[model samples]
Target: MSKTTPKYLLLSLPTSVVPSHHADDALEAISTTVSAENGSAAPFSIPEFKIGTLDALVQQADELAKLESQCQGVVAKVADALRNILDGDEAQIERMMVVNDKPVDQYLRTFQWNKVKYRADKSLAELIDLLHKEGASIDNDIRFKYSQYNQVKNTLATLQRKQTGNLSTKSLASIVDPRTVVQDSEYIETHLIAVPNSQEKEFLKNYETVAPMVVPRSASLVASDNEFTLYAVTTFKKHSVEFVHKARENKWIPRDFKYVEGGKEEERKEVERVGGDERKVWGETLRLGRTAWSEAVMVWIHVLVLRVFVETVLRYGLPLDFVSALVRTPSSKQADKAKKNLDDKYSYLAGNAFGRDKKGRVQRDDPQDMHGAGEGSAEYTPYVFYEFEFN
Candidate 1:
C-alpha cells in the first residue's frame, strides 16, 4: 500500500514529520487521529500497544511539556528586566519581583498599588497649602502693625495738641520781658521798669503757660503751617531765640505761601475747575506751587502718561492682581516702567480725554514715540510707549 501522509502530528514531533497546516486545525486533527488509534479517544486514554510505540508517545508528551516550561521561563526573565528599569528604589524592585512570580491579573493589581504609593509620597499639594497659610499670616501681621502705628501716632498728636497752645502771636511783648528802665536825673523822675529778673526766666514762664493752647501739636520734625509756629517755639528754645528770630526775618515767602490765604486766586480757581472739590484742588495747587512751573507741567504730563498705561493693560484682559505681581520687584526698571504706565493710563481715563468705545470697552490711544540721541551717537532709536486701556 502507498504510505498515507499523516494530516497532523504532535507539536513535539520534528517539523519534517508534521504536515504543513494551520497549528490550531492540526492540533484538533491530531487529537481525533490519536483517539481512533487508541481504544478510547479521550485525552487521558492510552492504547494497549507494543512497548516501542508507547515509549514514543510518552517521549512526545515530555518534550511538549518542556517546551511550554521554557516559554514561561523566558517571559519571567523579560518581566524581571522591565521591573528593574521601572522601579526607582529597592523596595519597589522587590515588590515588582514578587508580583512577577504571581499570575498576570495579580501583577496588574500590584502595579496600581505602587503607582498610588509613589504619588502620595511626593505630592506638592501640601506645600501649596502651607504657602497659603504663611501668606495669610504675613498679611494679617502687616495690617495689625499698620493699625497699631496709626493709633499710636493719633494718640501722640492728641496729647501734643492738648499740651501746646497757639504759638503764633502778633504781640512779641507777650513773650518777651520789658527792658529795665534807669532813673538818673537832676530832679526826681519816675520811669517804667521790668521786674528784677532775667528775660529768659520771663520767657520760660510764658512758654509753660502758652504751650497748652498750641493747636494741632504733634511730634513730627517738620510741621504744616498750622503746626509750624508751634514747633518754632520748641526750636527757638532749643537753639538761640535770636537765631530763630533772624531765620524767620530772612524767610522769603515759599511759593506755597502764595496760595495759602490771599495769594493767586486764579491758580486756585483753575485747580478747582480741573478737580471737582475745592479742598482737593487746593492741595494739588499747593503741591504744584512748591515746584517750578516747568516741573509742575512735567508732573501733569506724568499723570497723563500713567493714565494711558492703566487703561491699555485693563483692555488686554491682564488681571490687576497679576499686574501688581509683575511690578512687585523693587529695583527692576521694567517693573518701574510698568507702574508708571499704569498710573498714566489711570490718569488719562480719570481726566476724560479718552472714553469707552461703542461696546463700552476702554479704547487705548496710540502712545507718543520717544527717542534718545547723544553727542557721540547721532543715530536715534524709536522707544516703545508702554500704555494700557482703562474702563
Candidate 2:
C-alpha cells in the first residue's frame, strides 16, 4: 500500500551441499537467520536444461544475466505505468506480479517447472535465446500500447476543454441560438462578440455607432459567464472586417463563427465518439499492461534460472546438480541480513577465484578487475544471486 515493491533474493547452490530431501533447509536456514519474524522462502524450480558446449554456455550465461536485469527493469516500469493508470491507487490489485494467471508468490510456492512450455530437450542456449526474444518483444509492446492510450486520452481532453472554457475561448456551438443568428442575409451579417462583464453596458450603448451601417438595437445577449458576456450583433456585410477590428480596439473580443444546422447536436456526437474511443483504448492498454507484466516477469525468471544453471555448471563443474530458491524478506534490513548470511554460508563456493580481506570476508573483485571475465561477470557473487521487486 505504500508503493514499496516486494523484493526477493534468488539463489542457487550445488546439490552436493543441499540434498533433495533437505532442499528447503538452506532457504529455511537463511530465513531464520535473517528475520524469523518477517522472512520467508520457497523452492525456486529450475528444470535441468541441456547445456551445450562449455564455451557457448558461458557466453549465453553472460547474455542471459543481462537479459534478466532488463526483464526486471521492464516489469518495474510497467508496474509504475499501470499504477498511474489506476489513478495512483496505493492499494491497487496489480501491485503483485502474475504468471500463468496466478500471483507470482503462489506460483513460486507451487512451481513444477513447465517442461511443456520450455522443452528441456532444447539446448540451454536456445532456451535463453527464446526468453530474451520474448522479453524484448513484451517490452516493445507495452510501450506502444501505453503511448496509444495517451494519444486518445489527450484528444478527448482537448475536446472537453473547449466546452468548459470562458466565453472568449469556449466553443459557441452549443450556446448560440439559431433564431438569434441573421441567417443568409446578403446585406446583414451576424457577428459574435465577447465583451468583458465590466464593459457590458458600454458595449450595449456604442455597438450601433462603432462602425458604418450597423443595425440599431440588433445586439442581443447570447450567453454569459463570470468574466465575460457573449453578444450577437448584425451589421452591413461590407463593414464586417472593420467592425471586428473596432470591437478589438475597444477591448472586446470578436469570435469567428459559421452557423451550421444542428451544430450543437454535432458537437455532442463528436464528444461521444471521442469519449468512447478513449475508454476503449484505456481498457485495452490496461489489459495489455497486465499481460505484459506477467510475461516480462516470467521471462525474467526464466533468464535467471538459465544463469543459475550455467553458472552452477561453470563454477561447480558438472553432473547438473544444484538447488535453486526464492527468498522474500519483509524489509530491506532483512534482505541485507539474508544476503550476509548467504554470503557467509557459501563464500567457500567462490573458492580461489575470490580472496579474503582483513575482516575475513570474501572480497569480491571490482568491476575493473572483472574485465575479460565475461559480459555479465562484472558482478561476481559467491553463489548465483539475483533480486527483483513486485508491489
Candidate 2 lDDT by residue in tens digits, 178-228: 888888887888999999999999999999999999999999899999999
Task: Specify the highest-TM-score model's number.
Answer: 2
TM-score of each: 0.16, 0.77
* Global lDDT of each candidate: 0.28, 0.77
In the range 162-247, model 1's lDDT, one tens digit per residue, is 33433331212222222211123343221111111223244333432332322122112222234222222322223333433433
Q: Where does candidate 2 stray beyond 4 Å? A: 1-3, 15-38, 90-92, 95-97, 177-222, 231-255, 352-356, 360-362, 365-379
Clashing pairs in 2: 95-391
Error of 1 at 230 (Å): 18
Worst 10 residues of 2 by lDDT: 366-375
